[model samples]
Target: MDKLRKALSGRDNSDEQEEERGNIMTQTEDTPLLRVMDNSTLSWNTRVKGFAICFGVGFLFSFLGSVFLFLPNGITIFAVFYTIGNILGLGSTCFLMGPVSQCKRMFATTRIIATIIMFAALAMTLVSAFVLHNKALALIMVVIQFLAMTWYSLSYIPYARDAAKKCFGSCLDL
Candidate 1:
């Protein structure tokens, strides 16, 4: 019984130690924003949990939005829910990569155009839904949003954009 108890306590201690190791932060250059991000960084487990919850909510919102498309005022409802889901999904990445790093990557030269288009599409989606109330325009903007987001995501993978361009060019030529 005593041996079993020691083993259980040892396991608990190792878990705590592992958590502490994950929580340790390394010093970086002393800039105000970096300092804030460094200070605000969460433990690995907490970060993963936050990311999962946020991403799940984002997916649910998008699914609900799609479901509402057949009802009255469905376009506006769909636009709003879909836009919110995209925002949440984008924001969820910040949990895995610090906000500063995420922003830097977002605005990087290769992806800047895609990022701008994505953001513009998101804004236009809302504007079309609320202000213009044009279902066709809203749908168009949603398509743009999805494409821009895809392009932006592809920018993160090396040569992905080039490969896509080549594939599309060949298809167009054919």
Candidate 2:
């Protein structure tokens, strides 16, 4: 049990000097957020689980959208999915707080821009599909969302992988 606790805490007996630096620096290494973002052994597992969760949620939303896409009020279903996804996304942002705080000056504006574009696409989809009830416009919004997602994946994923590499050394698999 003690071994398990120590391993989970991410401490090495050889790193006693780190503890003297300060509580925040010492505690940060063991934080779950940091582990998710940077730990070589654990980050990949956490990322896989997060990907699964996002995929499952997205599948559910897609299924619902397909089921109601033809109905007169079908767009509302997609709107609900958008709302739920947004809420989930907001909750997930908490995981980034530690990393963001630790390296505020390092964050790239491109990442922020890509994220904003993605959110704008979501908003466009919700407004066009649900509020305006314009199927064609909604389709356009979806295309925009796809493009935004591609942009974000290209820009942010590489940045995150690189950051993880820097944090955990080249051995970090991201």
Candidate 3:
């Protein structure tokens, strides 16, 4: 019994040490926001799980939106679902990278314009769907949203935008 108790206590101590090691890996910044974000950071396993779940939900919403595109009065439904899915998909990165880092990367100079356009397109999609109730306009906005999002995503890959531009330019020249 005494041996078992000692082993249990040792296990507890090792767990505590592991936790301390994890905490040490997270660099603390002086800013309050950074500190708060650091404090809220999840374990690696939790972060991975959160990312997977959020991304899966986002993909499901987008697929459902596409399915609704064929039904009557479905443009509005499609727009809403698609917009929400895009938002969720974009937000899922926050789980992998803390919110502060995610926001910083999104607003970084290289991708700022694309990010802004994507956000505007997302907002306009919903506005056209619900407020204007214009199916054609909503569809147009959804296309814009997709293009903007694609451009924004490409910004993450080095020189991808330039390559895309060159490819399009060559195709147009043909």
Candidate 4:
């Protein structure tokens, strides 16, 4: 009886230790959604990604726009428009990153939608660059990137606010 009790106690102590270790591990380092999750913000991943995609798109097109048009024209009205659009797109993308880093929830549909937007923007950017062969195509790419940034910001702001009210909508407490 004494020996059996000792073994049981030993096993229980080890189990408790393992649990503590696991908790420590979990507390450190977080995923894109996890930071937001702690704050009850779940839609950050898509938001950040959406913003990032836009920034990338904007930067690339703006570079092209500048190289192909602005330099030659010396910052005309069209150049200013392109610059303004690209700057807005970049700013929106940067803003999305903050919320995304805080997000903790995982929703497949949101991710899918974000992915679709990213891929579509990428394809559009390339298509416009190669096939269209005009200033309009560049303008279109800048506009699309800006739109993506706007959409991401719109989707995230509400999610962060809503998440603050509920943890994972049913899981983990923020």
- The backbone clash count of each candidate, in order, is 0, 0, 0, 7
Candidate 2 accuracy as TM-score? 0.50
Q: What is the overall TM-score of model 1 with all chains considered together?
A: 0.76
Off by over 4 Å in 3: 1-36
Which has the greatest TM-score?
A: 3
Full-model lDDT for every candidate: 0.81, 0.57, 0.81, 0.50
Each prediction's Cα RMSD? 10.0, 10.5, 10.3, 16.2
Per-residue lDDT for 58 in model 4? 65
Model 1 lDDT per residue over 1-174, tens place: 545433312325764576567643434455766554651446666766878999999999989999998898799999999999999999887776667667877898998999999999999999999999999999999999989988998886779989999999999998
Tens digits of per-residue lDDT for model 4 on 54-129? 7777667566656656455433334444555455464553343343332321124554464356446645655655
For model 1, the superposed segments whose C-alpha errors exceed 4 Å read 1-36
Backbone clash pairs for candidate 3 read none
lDDT of 1: 0.81
TM-score of 4: 0.35
C-alpha lDDT (0 to 100) for residue 19 of candidate 1: 56
TM-score of each: 0.76, 0.50, 0.77, 0.35
Q: Which residue pairs collide, candidate 1?
A: none
Per-residue lDDT for 18-124 in model 3, tens only?
76786543545457665546524466668768889999999899999999999988999999999999999998877776676678789999989889989998999
Model 3 lDDT, residue 2, Cα:
43
Q: In candidate 2, which residue ranges exceed 4 Å CA deviation?
A: 1-20, 23-51, 82-107, 156-174
